[model samples]
Target: MFGGGGGGGRKPLDYEELNENVKKVQYAVRGELYLRASELQKEGKKIIFTNVGNPHALGQKPLTFPRQVVALCQAPFLLDDPNVGLIFPADAIARAKHYLAMAPGGLGAYSDSRGIPGIRKEVAEFIERRDGYPSDPELIYLTDGASKGVMQMLNTIIRNERDGILVPVPQYPLYSAAISLFGGSLVPYYLEEEANWGLDFVNLRQTVASARSKGITVRAMVIINPGNPTGQCLSEGNIKELLKFCFHENLVLLADEVYQQNIYQDERPFISARKVLFDMGPPMSREVQLVSFHTVSKGYWGECGQRGGYFEMTNLPPKTVDEIYKVASIALSPNVPGQIFMGLMVNPPKPGDISYLKFSAESKSILESLRRRARLMTDGFNSCRNVVCNFTEGAMYSFPQIRLPPKAIDAAKRAGKAADVFYCLKLLEATGISTVPGSGFGQKEGVFHLRTTILPAEEDMPAIMTSFKKFNDTFMDQYDGYSRIIQYYITPSVKT
Candidate 1:
């Protein structure tokens, strides 16, 4: 009945005929600028890649306890060996054995479509401890990474082109890329740069109103606590306000809390949306739909390559939960080793565990170093000519606003690039510092910025910042200085 051979004449997929949605997706984290950085690396240039929040690639040492447990799980044969304890700590061996028992078929075998049940339990416990609220294992779904979970939820919500998701302007490019790929509208609410990139409730209401006026049905609101690029951790008070807004507006809350543990500012510590909702009690907790996401890719552990993450749903209808499960079942299973890593991350060595001391010291050192690097990079940008950056309160990035002269804007126009993109290209050429332009992250028009991770090695961070300062000082002087020279030449003869 099916004309299989008839499709043979269709030739290779024509770029012109490809899905327009696919064509619309643009992940600036690995966009044209990233490609150029890769080219420079191949040509033997020393490039400091701050394009994405990839910590291990930037020299962050992996937490030993997780790696040890995972290494044993990867080769279960070693666990049975009598002398395996000689090389591995008792707690790690025990933990590995516990997880191995849960997955009798081993890490190589397929897990539940959701994840390893035991590990999911551990994640639930971790959440309970962190938020002082109960989290259900059945509601949690382990994903290949938080990004996969985000796309899955987006797919569930975006039934058609007019379905809109309220996303932050200057957001992680993944949100934009996923919205485009799924053929959904992205309604943007801008964070106020004048106020440490904080959210403004009035602005949010206006954005939502604007989207609805255009006939788009706004479905969900995404909040990246301890935000990416901007790195502003949402206070608990702020989270409560967001919950109220979502409840009143009947919008789902998608909280991206991957940077929960990366917080550096005590005054603005990380707070989960789930916690705030329950704290508000009654109507808000019982009715407002919420989906909270976490990943092993971020924070001090920095297990980006492992691709372990999870999202917990709250207040969703049973049928909706079943549908999400059905979609996950299509993937067969999440990454098994990644699930194990997620377990370790959520339930690391406790006080009496043999590896506790080493784990504590290692994780603490990494975090302290990152805190210092965050300050170093922020201060470096502030000191640079025509550049001002907010302090990185949590996430691994510094988004510095660069005030360019008219001449630079003209140059960028002639080169057929956004002003910031042109400036980033020039920065890469001069100092091999690869950063994503603000245009990539959907900044407010006429204002330009760039995103850089503070993940470089601590010893080398100073030198990196110094190198960036040298190049930036020269860039500003060349572009911003041109205006002064013209102004001097045209000034109506100043009578002494």
Candidate 2:
């Protein structure tokens, strides 16, 4: 033993030595339940993961053209193989070669700290096509995923515990996790679930004022347009109002628009915060800083493993942008294949191009499947006793509110668990259905909900729904003693 001088008897790193901020972080999507599920899977149980918006995990196939190009780039020698044309289309081969030229040394090499300039340009072009406005490639940062960019932005904004972010209740846990990790406060604003999960400005104002009253300096607000957990897209009018709120309050707007291409409702099409801000012109555009995040993970591409995403900074100070780049530099570069994937995602084949037909067909098929799954899951959940789910207008989740029996709540308490977590664990155990509890995402006190992705294959949904309904019914039956109490609370008897 070296005593206090060296290694022999020194204690290993543990919770006490960990960062306090790290200790506060809890991401329930892959928390205890998911870990248990994984353990069960290793034991050969067929667990269906509905906990996260991971499409490919649920059998969503990647698009042909992107994969082909990626494959060719990964093995550029494939282009020289005489059978290349036999396996890959002409356009894919050409695209791969093009990206190779763009990359400093193809997939093996690191790109510019910001990203490949050409790829960023393509991203900018994609934005211009989407918004009818110009985008600067220089303002873009290629990230491992949209989440990295979001966390980086939070890092720049949060200086201490006094700093807070205005985060929506029933939001994706990423925002909350990042705020915790950054040692910042999450000033909660409850979204109106009764009103199709609408953002109530009155609630926002009150939340901001209350946080301010408590000396929490609210510096940023996050909007997951085509929302996560709650899959309702923001109307243009609503977006305009939100922009106004940010402008008046001097809060930065963080737009999570990764689901921009996942819109299913014709009436509720996706709109970028940048587009709205620019349309408002000058003061609105100049004053309010907006950072919008997009990814190749959630769209029809469903290339979650690629880890490709970008965040465009609007109205941010040039100096701040430089800081972001400097931070990115420490990471060396975003994944090169991911950067190429981003390019493919933003600039798919044109109509006249050879791969156009296949690309369009593949993209359309995936979108249609997702739309069908969303509708099917929403209907099934709404039909369940004491459960209400709004139809998903966009994004890939159905966050259904469950009315837990008081008996069930008591049972959960006895188990030292939240009621929704108790319900989700039961569902998982009974039917191999994994889900994230609303407590993890934040919900009104006394309200119980669970978020399930609509990413399961269409063919598998009917059986999944049947299993879910049966488990729910059986669980409710077990808690029948509290059913009458819930009924009484909702509808009191009138004495004549």
RMSD (Cα, Å) for all candidates, in order, is: 4.7, 3.2
Query: What's the TM-score of every candidate structure?
Result: 0.95, 0.96
- The parts of candidate 1 lying over 4 Å away from their true place are 1-12, 482-496
Output the lDDT of residue 416, model 1.
98
**Clashes by residue pair, model 2:** none
Model 2: per-residue Cα lDDT over 153-250, one tens digit each: 99999999999999988889998999999999999898887678897898789899999999999999999989998999999999999999999999
Q: Model 1, 214-301: lDDT tens per residue?
A: 9999999999988887899888888899999999999999999999999898888888899889989998899999999999999888
Error of 2 at 74 (Å): 0.8
Report lDDT per candidate.
Answer: 0.90, 0.89
- Model 2 weakest lDDT span, ten residues long: 487-496
- Stretches off by above 4 angstroms in model 2 are 1-3, 6-12, 481-496
